[model samples]
Target: MSPPKSAQRLENKWDASRAKNMSEPEKLLYRSNLLGSDKRITNYGGGNTSAKVLQKDPLTGETVEVLWVKGSGGDVGSIAMDGFSTLYMDKLNALRGLYRGVEYEDEMVAYLPHCTFNLNPRAASIDTPLHAYVPARHVDHMHPDAIIAIAAARDSKALTQQIFGDTIGWLPWKKPGYELGLWLSDFCARNPDARGVVLESHGLFTWADDARDCYDLTLDIIQTAMDWFAEQTAGKDAFGGARHQSLPADQRRAAASRLMPAIRGMVSGQQHMVGHFTDSDAVLEFVNANEMERLAALGTSCPDHFLRTKIRPLVVDFDPAKPDIDATLAGLADAISDYREDYMAYYERCKHDDSPALRDPNAVVYLVPGVGMITFAKDKATARISGEFYVNAINVMRGADAVSEYRGLPEQEAFDIEYWLLEEAKLQRMPAPKSMAGRVALVTGGAGGIGSATAERYLREGACVMLADIDETALAETAENLSARYSADVVRTVTMNVTDEAAVVSACSNIAAEFGGVDILVSNAGIASSAPVEETTLDLWNRNMAILSTGYFLVSREAFKLFRVQDMGGAIVFVASKNGLAASPNASAYCTAKASEIHLARCLALEGAPMGVRVNVVNPDAVLKGSKIWQGEWLDQRAGTYGTDKDGLEAMYRDRSLLKRSVLPDDIAEAAYFLASDLSAKSTGNIINVDAGNVQAFTR
Candidate 1:
């Protein structure tokens, strides 16, 4: 449906207001709101925005500073000045020559010192180079829902040509990070006067000498596509006007639980998971309808979305009248398996790596026969966004079919773009400790010593952090203290148990709703228990696993969901101790749980790799300022074992590391920021040493 004329006028007025704004903050907020207004409008961290600011660098004299280009973790609507990583334009432009060969990530990290900032934060945007490459004073890149929908249709190229005319240039899909930057750099260099660039199976990029021009160009391009789609689909009977049926809330929840593990496994190794389920009558009935297969064959609107929605939706052939629930589930599994095998064959034909393929599909659209269509996501927010895109795609496809057949990217081409080398280059950039700005992070167990230090480091690096912990009093007090020092928004507090599934869900939902989606998730919530393996009771093991192992799973799960669905892919930092690698005496449960987390991070890294999500672990040794294991009896026990007094014992642990210093929470947090930012994009599943130099013992 076309947006009402009045709403269009309001948008126009807002655009005018934004154009008139000379203040940096106002322009930032304006562009953010514009990008956030639609679901299909932006992929999680898939797009970018920037504004040129006049600043005087100490040595560079007067130079334009890109005051803020949306950092890796920020959402357009909620991002602030702090969300943008400021860089001297001359330096950024000069670095163009520095980007060479396959080792971009390392090069970027090494160059972090060149960029001056009060806080040496980690992780810049993957497209930092692209933003730097653009000579425009302001730039906006987005994967607008309307554009993706149109682009996903059968004749995307023709449609694009019809709608955007010559103002936009279409580049076939390539992996996003470095290759994209390179491709864009070449394109911009070749066509200096081009208004924008559209990445096939990806999104759109717009730029101008001013912020307002770039913002309006994005809106105009998307609106044109939306209008073309509406015109093309005006009288399509392809939808069949089928409506979906709703299921009982309990059943829906149960179904979601059953699907969560598969979804988690699919996107494992990354942090953050956001899922949404729709059992509305229209969805269910349409899903279960006879023509469902025909409907499902319509490919994803864009290639990038494949990481989120997968290649196609799962159509469940549900028989609500079945007397045997187990049998029905078995049948569902069989059907899903068949679908998965078919997908694997497609992958095998194009497979480039020996890594096992994802077991869970990115999206599952179930057809409960008489019921409605239901979609599952890693997180609710993602599911909702996926649903929005699917609905729009369906509408456009149906409309196009009314006039003629719909077409999408050719299969081989789609695969090539999906596995493009350029895209791979983008994913491998290292974290820049000095360039991170305007990003937000949520560090669980923030009241703990490691968490507190990490939070402080993030604050120091110019990131807004939401510190969550089970210790409400401590969490609140810490947040208060941090707030007193930083901007009120820079530090917020949430008290919740990570073990409670509901709390995990609520926490993620609330964070996204409040801070736009978190850019970094530091899964540092854990418990330490030491007992002989033979003496460890089931209860003790279960409790340890619940908080230490399962808690990381829950938090990382939610974070991945959010990150996947948002425009910017986020970074996740899991805090596992050296014990995770090397066993400690009488610490079986603790070691086992930590080890599990490490493995989980590895899995997440693989899954998130294709989507710009980077996951890494920080193994800090003997930084026990806030750990339960650091207090009274535990301290005495550890000191006695080490044959020294408390302080001496601490030094013993510190000296075990190459650095010969206590690994502070700040150290871990700094590592976390690096992993979460552009600085560590290529370093997923990496085990970063925050433990000084304790690797020899751990390896031995």
Candidate 2:
């Protein structure tokens, strides 16, 4: 049967025209991509799809059934042909005897590799057997919110029968492994007419002989549940309706910005964590509801949800009426400590003798009333995905609580999945994190050569970057290019006139909102002036000081405020100039402003030392390539002073240096990176000269 046409909540996206010419495996990939593209169908990396095709065996020249399923740790939306694990169907079936019993089923995962066909390198997922044992040619396993809502409800088996009668069956909760695969096989054998079955507190599994039919069945099942919920939950208050009105959009963001840094600071004890904040309509509605806390305490039901968001989220205590951020800030330490204690207690209460040691006890998702959701992880992409998973849980809770009583996986069941030995082994297999994985940097003049170079250096080591610059067009272009190289989740941009206090303040807030807080501050915004003391106008001199001196102070002060909030030792790298120490002809104002920057770093070092903030300088001289200052009149003026033209000035400067080398933007960037990284942890209040060994600028 199809979803009822009159009440269908999902539109069938299949085009026979698109699928007519596709081979069996190609159709499997096409179907999987279509299902995964919409989050309503499944979350990122949440589901699997497979097709059984008759193919010639490599060793024997006879046709054999082969199971092609999605590989472990792969996302179906972007899965390539290589992402599928191919295995002999007969060999997979033989594994039914290898399974000793339900208690020894996990050991079956170790035997999956022996069934590999064609020496395929991709590892099969634990759900591989579930797909293999199904009698149909194509199978779809998805965690759609609508179906999961019904599956996670109280007496979900009764709910399933009422909704789809005998067509769709229901099974009690079974930990996914070889044993669960046998259950599905047995269910299909007994009820040959059933199209699918919902695994309680898990997800849906649907199959059909035809690829297009399987795709249609999966969507139809989800839409049927969706349509039924719409009818049943119509005009019903979701999550007991709104207990607190949502604050205005701007105020919500303001509150998020105010609280994010302090929370980031308190949680970053080992490796730092980057944060993601979302104030979507779903998040706002859920956060303002009266039953929000009660429902959240029950935790998420789906295994994939707990894999990303943990057992539950920590609900931040904040009243919409009061809007007292300071009060919330004062209580964060205790709030966070209490959450940690409770998480440890959970581990103690439910852990098995051989369970993997308790993981980070901190909650990945944080819910704030009148604001939105905040999530933190080792990096920006993970943090963002964690937030997305919790939103999925929020949708499931809203639907289940509306029609039937919402039920979460029991605490012991959740802990079993959470601390499963297989899950822990998968995590252990991950590559070591990049040096700057969880760090955040705010780069001033980020569109300029030195600024962009420094930002890239940090990004390569896995830091989140906020590119702040006065040039809006250039900032956008640079951010776009950097984001393309790294995923967009790690790079953000803000426009600001660094000399303006208000603009600097806003830039700081935007950066904090974008990525928890600042770990590195690269103060590089400046303009070069080429004039004798007599020719230099007061406007020109003041302009130089305004950007090069006061501008640095404004941005630095804001960064310090975040550092203080985080209570984390951070790095401040000032891109001053060789002229700050060595004399330069016809550049008094430029040299004076540069000198002011150098002194400022030293002063900051004295005050920041107690808090573990290291202040240092990278003094670069005659960086001709990609320097905005050198692109303007500064180049011609410096050339004229040296009795050479613009083309000859770079050569003249290179020859004038002790090592006779022309310093480039990358050279300065390297020095800036060293100062900002832990490599220079003990060298605060120091300066590194990237001037091809200019003797006069040497710090020693």
**C-alpha RMSD of each candidate structure in angstroms:** 13.7, 2.4
Q: Residue 136: error of model 1 in Å? A: 2.4
Q: Report the C-alpha lDDT of model 2 over 32-71, residue by residue, as the tens digit.
A: 9989888888999998999999999989989999999999
Model 1 per-residue lDDT tens digits across residues 427-543: 455354334454668989888877888888878876667888898888988888888887564577888899998988877765653344567898988776767789889998998
| Candidate 2 wrongly placed segments (more than 4 Å) | 1-11
On a 0 to 100 scale, what is the lDDT of residue 687 in model 2? 87
| Candidate 1: 10-residue stretch with minimal lDDT | 1-10
Candidate 2 residue 90 C-alpha distance from true site, Å: 0.9
Residue pairs of candidate 2 with colliding backbone atoms = none
TM-score of 2: 0.98
lDDT of each model, Cα atoms only?
Answer: 0.65, 0.91
Model 2's alpha-carbon lDDT is 0.91
